[model samples]
Structure formats: structure tokens, C-alpha cells
Target: MSSLPADISLDTLTPEAVAKTIDHALLRPDMTVDEVVEGCRLCARYKTASVCVRPCDVRVAAGELKGTGVAVGTVIGFPHGSSPASVKVCEALAAIDDGAEELDMVLNIGRLKSGRTGEVRSEISQVVRAAKERLPGCCVKVILECSLLTDDEKVAACRAAEDAGADYVKTSTGFSSGGATLADLRLMRASTDPATTRVKASGGIRTLDYLVECLQAGADRIGASATAAIVDDLRARKASAPSA
Candidate 1:
């Protein structure tokens, strides 16, 4: 939704070779409306691809960014995907109503680990249905907390998210013990079918180097609180390079 051009075929935005890899995240649980408004404003000012925030402020963000192209996104199950199916649906519906253009739901890690892949898949599908029904045309990203899963489980989750109709398979909730790793990103990137799915790298990504790495590893988007710093770093690097 960011006006910065999601497609990089022409490559005119940033020259880091991966400007699209950075998504400006504002998922503070206690972020106030005024703060969200300001936070989203900052994301737009910096030309971030998207702004991911808590559900409570999705509508406010959407309203604030009508023409900015900066997408409005929110977390569904959030750090824990253990909520019941009904609960996740309600949250997704509410977030859409509040103007979220995208939903990032946490997968039921426990259920998946407990051999409840069916239930996990169902939960994600239902949430996706709810989002699409409400938004009509929108995207849904499922957070798998990849650090906790075995490679096989990660692959299974990626496939499940794809089958469940999620637009992207995300790395973490930023509340986990670890965050996106290059290895995990690569594994997931290759695991998901690129034709119908994407990889979102979030959680502990706070540098330009990491951002570039995420993009090269097949990340379609990034979730970071350090958006300004990264962009500034890109600008600085460009400014210091000798003119050809």
C-alpha cells in the first residue's frame, strides 16, 4: 500500500538493492491513538512500504494515510496464536473494520507442535476468510515464529499458510526469544510458492545490512521499528559514494 512503489522492476526508489525489504512497524501494545497517528505519519514521511501497528489503531492509521501508499496493517493473534478460532476471527474482523489493509496473525504454535496441523490450518483459513470478506481485497500474513519450529515444521507451516490463503508467511512476532535469521528466511523463501505467497521478515531486524540481506533472501517485506535509521543509512551511503 506504500506509495513508494512495491514493484522494483524499474529500481528508482532506494539504491540499496532492497528498499522494498523494509516495512516500518509500529506494533507497540500500549501505543496511544495520538502516538499511532504520529507513528504512521513518521512512516509516511520516511516513505516506508507499510506501517504495522496494534489493532486498536488500525482505523486511525488508515484514515491518516489515505493517499500516502503506506499500508495499514495490524496483528491478529499477536504474540500468541493460542486464542480460539472464534476469538481470532473476531479480532481480524475488528481490525479490518478499523481500516487495516493487511492482517498479520500469529499461528497457533502450540497446536502445530501438538500435532494439530488441521486445527492450525483451519484457524488461519478462517481468519483469512474473515479478512477477505471484510476487506474484500486485502492481504493476510501469518506469523510462524520460525525460530521455535524445526525446519520441517516451518516448511509445513508455510505450506499450510499457502493452503489457508495467506498472502505472506512472516517470520516472528518480535516477542519471541529470537527473530528473523538469514537461514530461516532462506528456508521459508524457498518453502513457499512464490507465485502465490511471499516472505515477511520481522522481529529484531534493525540495520540496513539486515534489510538488504532480507530482500536478497527473498523477503518481500520487512517489519522494523528502525525504519528511519535504515533509510537514513541508505541515504548516507548514497551521498558518500563518489559520483560516477
Candidate 2:
């Protein structure tokens, strides 16, 4: 994350700013290549931070968004994090080779729930290592799937992510029972070093108002498929706001 001036306020955030904070989700398994193309176009048109797609779509997304400034991102462990650490590492490596600039890897929820903190941290670290090894500039966001965890577990997950050298700690997988909430975002933000590990709110953030709330709560990015609605509403609000 680039450094912004200290006085920056959410109320004054522009469409460009909002777009830059979004990772336009295109990860549904049923999505076709044509749909992925269209989604990439929308991300490029909006100049979003990236187009978060499934691992197999990394190359296509990268090709579509080439030279557009928007990046190509894909999930590592994905909706479920039960994959072996080696598998996650291989996925990260393949993703980077396929032109992914960012990787959102899911934490092993069952292991985490079982108090296997070392294994969880080790797995995250391994994937982070694989990503950074293949593409030194690639960013990794470790998804905690917060809705299924207690507040204490959430904090623990944030710490584990930070310890694992992840660039960010994300709130949810969107496949879980619930998605990101302002409270979870705030807790994540508070748990990690903001300068090093930023917060990404994912899953249920489909509205302009909810996006604003996430930002206010210190989320640096929003993972959503409802990109059009959020961007449209932001533009309309900006257009109607009283002039200074």
C-alpha cells in the first residue's frame, strides 16, 4: 500500500480512490471465460486494484488487463484451506508464473479451530514464501474467514498472518456463513501493524455505504463482485454533493 497524506478522509474519497481500493471478484466456479473477459474489462475501465479470479483464470485475466495498471489476482487455497502446505505453495508459484500480482490464500480453518496455530502459521508462511520467491513484488492476503471464528480467534489469525509475512489479512472467503463486517475489519486493523499488514474486507460488501464503512474501519481493500453498484453509487453521490 502506498502512503497517503495523513489528512485524507473517507468523506472526500473520489471514484478513483474507491476503485483503487477494490479487488473486483470474478471467482465464481460457474463463470465462463467470456464472463471473465467482461469482468476484467470492467476492472480495467474502473482502474481497480486488481481482478481477483480463480487460479486457472490468472493467465487470461493477466492478458486481458495487460498494461491497464490494474493487477491480476487469484486465490491460493480458496474457499477451503484444507489443501496441504505443498499444494498451496505450488498454487502460489503457478499463479505468479501465470502473471498474478496478488494472491489471497485461505487459512486452514479446521486447523485454526483445533488450536494448531503453528501449522496454520507455517502454511501461511510457506505460501507467502512461494509467492515472494516467484515474484518478489507479488502481494499476499491471508483470508481468515472471520465469520466462523470468535473475536479472540480473529485476533490470533491476524497475528499469525503478520508473523507469516503476509501483505494483508482479509476478513472472509465470501463462501462462509457470513461475510466481512465493520467490527471484524476494525479488529483486524487493530491487530496488525497497519504500515506492514493492511486490512482487506471481503464477502458481503456490496454497497457503497458498506464500502465506506469498511474504509472508515481501516480496510485498505474491498473484495466484491458488486463492483458496478458500488462505483455507480459513489459517482452519483459525488456528482450530487454540495460544492465546496
The candidate that wins on TM-score is 2
**Overall local distance difference test of candidate 2:** 0.90
Give lDDT per model, in order: 0.83, 0.90
Residue pairs of candidate 1 with colliding backbone atoms: 1-69, 2-69, 3-69, 59-98
Worst 10 residues of 2 by lDDT: 2-11
User: Which candidate comes out best when scored by lDDT?
Assistant: 2
Supply the TM-score for candidate 1: 0.91
State every prediction's TM-score relative to the real structure: 0.91, 0.96
lDDT tens digits by residue: candidate 2, 132-233: 888997899999999899998898899999999999999998998999998899899999998799999998888888888888888888999999888888
For candidate 1, write residues 1-244 as lDDT tens digits. 2333354332344743344455677777677788888888887787666788887777788888889877888898888888898999999988887888888999999988887888889999999998898888788999999888999899889989999999999999999888999899999989988888989998898987777677667787889988778878878877887788
What is every candidate's alpha-carbon RMSD to the true fold?
3.1, 1.4
Cα misplacement distance, residue 139 of candidate 2 (Å): 0.2
Candidate 2: segments with Cα more than 4 A from true spot: 1-10
